[model samples]
Target: MSETTDPDLDDSVRIADPSIDTDVIDRIESALEEGALADGPEVRAFESEFGAYCRTDHAVATSNGTTALHAALEALDVEDGDAVITTPFSFVASANAIRLAGATPVFADIDLETYTLDPADVERVLAERDDVVGLLPVHLYGLAADVSALCELADEHDLFVLEDACQAHGAAVRGDRVGGFGDAACFSFYPTKNMTTGEGGIVTTDREDVAERVASYVNHGRAENGTGDYDHVRLGHNYRMTALAAAIGRSQLERLPEFNERRRENAAYYDDRLADLPLETPTEPDGYRHVYHQYTIRTDDRDALADGLAARNVDAAIYYETPIHRQSAYETVSTAAAELPRAQRAAETVLSVPVHPALSERDRRVVVEEICDYFHNQ
Candidate 1:
C-alpha cells in the first residue's frame, strides 16, 4: 500500500509558534485597569490597525474565523437554497460558514500549483447554476487566491465575493492585499495563524453596508448607534472578540510584517535546500506574495515521508486530508460540477512541513534531512 494511505503516519513537528510576551500582558492589564475588557478599545483599535494593514475602509472584529465567514455570508444575503462557489480542498470552516448562513456550498476544483479555487471551474459552476449568490474563495496555505479573476466572475454573474483569508495574513495579489479584494474577507487570529489573538477573527471590507451588517451580525444584531444596552434589532449572535484577545492580537498584528518576513526567509531556505529531493515544493506564482502559513510539498509517498519525519521528531502536517465534499456533514448539500481530480490528488499527497518564524536553522536542516533520508531509504 502507498504511504499516503497510512493511518499511523503523522507529522511530528508542530507548525505554529505564537509568542505572547510582556507587551501583550501589559495591554491586557491596561484593558483590565480601564474596566473595558469586552469589545472595547482594544478590539476597536485592533480593527482599525488591521483594516489599515489590509487597506480596507472598515473591519469588524469577531470571536473567531468561522464567525467572520458566517457574518460575511450573512452580509452578502446568502440564504436557504442559495449556492456559493468555493474550493473543496480547504478547512471545513470555509464550507461550514456557507451552510451556517443558510446557503449550499458548491464545490469547485483547485489550481493544483496554487492550491486555490480554479476560475474556469468557478465560471462553469456559476454559468450552470442561477442560484449561486456568492463566490467564496480561500487563500489556502497563505497564498492569495485568484481574487482578480473571481471578482470578474462575480461581476458577470452578479454574485458577491467573500474571501476566506484565514491563513493569508500578509499575502497579496497584483500588489493589493487579499482581504480588500473581495466584498468582504475573513481573517483568523488563532494561535496557529501568522498572528495570534488566542482566539479571534475579523472581517475587512470597503463597503460600508457590508461592514455595518457584519458589525451588527456579530453583536447580536444591535444597531450601530446605540449605548451599551441590549437591543435586539435583528437576528444576530454573540460573536464579539474579547478585549483581552484583541489586546494580544494588537501586539501580534504589529509584529506581523516581521514575522511574515522570517517565514518567507525560512521558506526560501527550504526551496534551495530541498531542490534536489523527489517532491514538488510550494509554488509562488508571479504577482502573488505567499506568507508560507505551511510550506507544503506534494509527493506520492506523503504518508511514508510524514511518518519518517515524525519518527525523527519533525512535524509534517497534511492540511486537508479529506476534501470538503467528501466529509459526511456536507454530503447532502455539497455538489461538485464534475470530478475534482486535482483537489482529490492534492488531498491524498500534500504534506506541510514547519515554516514558522520560530524555526531555527538547525530545525530547518533536520526537516530536509529527514525527508531526504526517507526517500533514500525507500
Candidate 2:
C-alpha cells in the first residue's frame, strides 16, 4: 500500500495501470510459438479459467466490453422495441449497448450512496411501464450494484437481469461474485479495467442456452460448439478476441485478486485521510467488496479540485461528467419519466483520484496533501 513495497508509485499516479510484466510477455510469446493465433487454445483456456473464477458455467469472449453487453442483452432475448431499465450515472457504453441490441434504454435515477441504479426508483418505473423486458444494472466504479434486489424485481416482473460488471471484475456481494448474480454479466478487459486483454470482453452465465446463444452471435451467427464453417444459423458479428489478447487476459486474470487488493488498500488510505474533508469518499455497502477501479470523491467544487490536483502532478479524473440522457446521442431514443436528480448531481460533483495498484506511497501522500491543501486553505 505504500512505496516501501510498491516502489513504482513515484513514477506517476495514473487512474489505472495494465500491470503488464514478464508473465504477460511470456504468454504472448507462447501464443505466437503455437501455430494457432486465432480463437484457439488461448481463447478457450481464458474462457474456461475466467468462467471458473466467476463461478459461471460458460464465459463467451468478445471484441470488447460493449459487444459483450450487446450480445448479453440479445442472448437474454431482449428484442427490438423493448425497453431496458438502467441507471443514468454509468459510462455511456452501458446505455449504448442497449441501443445496439435494438432496445430503448429507460433512464432511472441512481442511489446517492452507491452511484448505482436505485431499486426503489426502478420498481416505481416498472410499475408504470410495461415494455421494460430487462434490467441492466451497472456495477459502476467497481462496486456491486444491488443485484439481490434487482433480481427480486426481475423475478416479480419476469424481467431479465444482465449485470454490467465491466468495472467490477472481482467485486462481490454477500460472498458471491458480481458476475455470478444476474442471468448473464458482462466484463470489460480494456487496459484501464481491473484486468486487461489489450481490448476484450466476456459474458459470464450459468444458463447453457445463454452461453450457446452468445457464443454463436459473437462468431458470425454460425452454429457453435464444433459446428462446421459456413453453417450460418443467424446473423452475427465477428466480435472474437484474438489468441494474443486472450493470453494477456489469462495472465492478467491470474493477478486480478492481487490487483484488487492493492486497489482496496489505496482506497482505504484515501478514505482515512480525506474523511474530514467536505467531499464525500467512496462507499462499500454492507457485504459488498468494492474493487476500486476509480476512487471517486464527490464535492461541489469538483472542477477546482481536479485542477488543483493536476497542477500538483496528481492525476485526478471525472468519470461521466455528463449523464447519458444529457448526451446528444441518447437524446433521440432515451426516455426519462421521473427526475434523475441524483445522477445529474453526481455528474456535476464527482472527481476520481489515483487509486490504482501502481501508485507509490509518495504519490499517495502527494494526492492526500494536495486535496487537503485545496479545501483547508480555501
Candidate 3:
C-alpha cells in the first residue's frame, strides 16, 4: 500500500476499483472471425486448470455465475418443492438459483460476526424439514463459512453440501480450500469479483456423474460419444462459456492468488488500526484464511459514518440492506418463520470498505483515519 495524505491537502489519496479489462481485442476479433469463439479449447483449458487449482477431479465452465449454481443443483437432482438450505445474507443468486432449480430456498439466519449461515439456525431448520436435499453455504466477503461444523450437520441429516465460493476465490478453511470443503463448489468470474473471466464461472466436484451431467447440461446435452452428433442426453441448457471469456480468465487466474494476498494485507492493516472504533473488524478464525474480498465492518451509526467517509471521497457502502428472506422478491418465503434479529441487525449496521488489490498504503491509512474520526466525534 502507499502513504496517506490529508483529505484537504493531498491530491491522489483516491482509491481506484481493481479489475482488468479484456485487452484481447485481437484474440476476440480473430476468434469471432474464425467462428471458434464459442465454448472451445480455451474454455476447456480454463476449466482444467481451475479444477486442478481447487483440487477437484472435474470442473465445468458455464456462461455465468447463476448458471453455475443452477447446474450444480440440477447435477444433484434437486427436486421441485425440495428445500435447499442456504443463507439469506448473501447475493440473490444463492436463493434464486434454488428456485430456478425447482426447489424452495430455506433461508437461515447468519452469524453476526462472520455474516455466514449460523450452524445452530441450520440445525433448527433441519429439525423441522429433514428432507433438505442440498445445503449451499456461501463463503461471504471471502471469509470461509464454518464448513467443518456445517458438514457435520449435513452428514447427520444426510444432505448434500455445496459451496457458493463466488466471493472467496483462493480462500481456505483449516488449510483446505473452499472448493474442496463441499461435494461441489461454484465460482464466479464476474468483473467485480477478486478474479474474473470477463464473464464466466467454474463448477468443481469429485463425482464423475455430476461432472458429466454438468458438462452435458451446459452444452445442449452433447454426450461425449459417437452417434446422433447433436444428441441430447439430458434436459440441459445453453450455458456454455465462450473461448474469449475463458482466455481473459486464464490471464486473471494466474494473478488471483497474489491479488487475494494483497486483500489480506489491507484487511490486516484495517484490523489493527480500526480496533478502537465502535465497529467490529472482520474475524479470521485461527484455521480460516480469509481473503477479505470486501473488508466490511459494523457501526451502530452506519449512515452517519458512511456519509462522513463519502465526504472525504472514500467510497464505503452497505453490501446488503435487506436479507434475502425479507426482500419483496421472497416475502412469501417461510425461512422468516423465526425472528432473524441477527440478519436484520447486520443489514442495518454493516458496511464494506474498499479492500481491492489496487489500494495503496496511503489509501488504506486515509480510510482508517476517517473511520477513527467518525468514532471520536460520536
By TM-score, who's the top model here? Answer: 2
Local distance difference test, candidate 3: 0.84
Candidate 2 is scored at a TM of: 0.96
Query: Candidate 1's residue-wise lDDT over 174-210, tens digit each?
Result: 8888899888999999888999888999999999999
* TM-scores for the candidates: 0.95, 0.96, 0.92
Better of 2 and 3 by TM-score: 2
Error of 1 at 372 (Å): 1.4
lDDT values, one for every candidate:
0.88, 0.89, 0.84
Q: Clash pairs of candidate 1?
A: 11-316, 12-315, 13-314, 13-315
Over the stretch 1-82, how does candidate 3's per-residue lDDT look in tens digits?
1223444585443333545644555556655766667767677788999998888899999998899999989989999879
Q: Residue-wise lDDT of candidate 2 within 241-343, one digit each (tens)?
A: 8999999998888889999999999999999999999989999999999999989999999998899988876778888898888888866764744478999
- Model 2 poorest ten-residue lDDT run: 1-10
Q: Is candidate 1 or candidate 3 better by lDDT?
A: 1
Question: Which structure among the candidates has the greatest lDDT?
Answer: 2
Question: Clash pairs of candidate 2?
Answer: 9-360
lDDT for position 175 in model 1 = 86
Rank candidates by TM-score, best first: 2, 1, 3
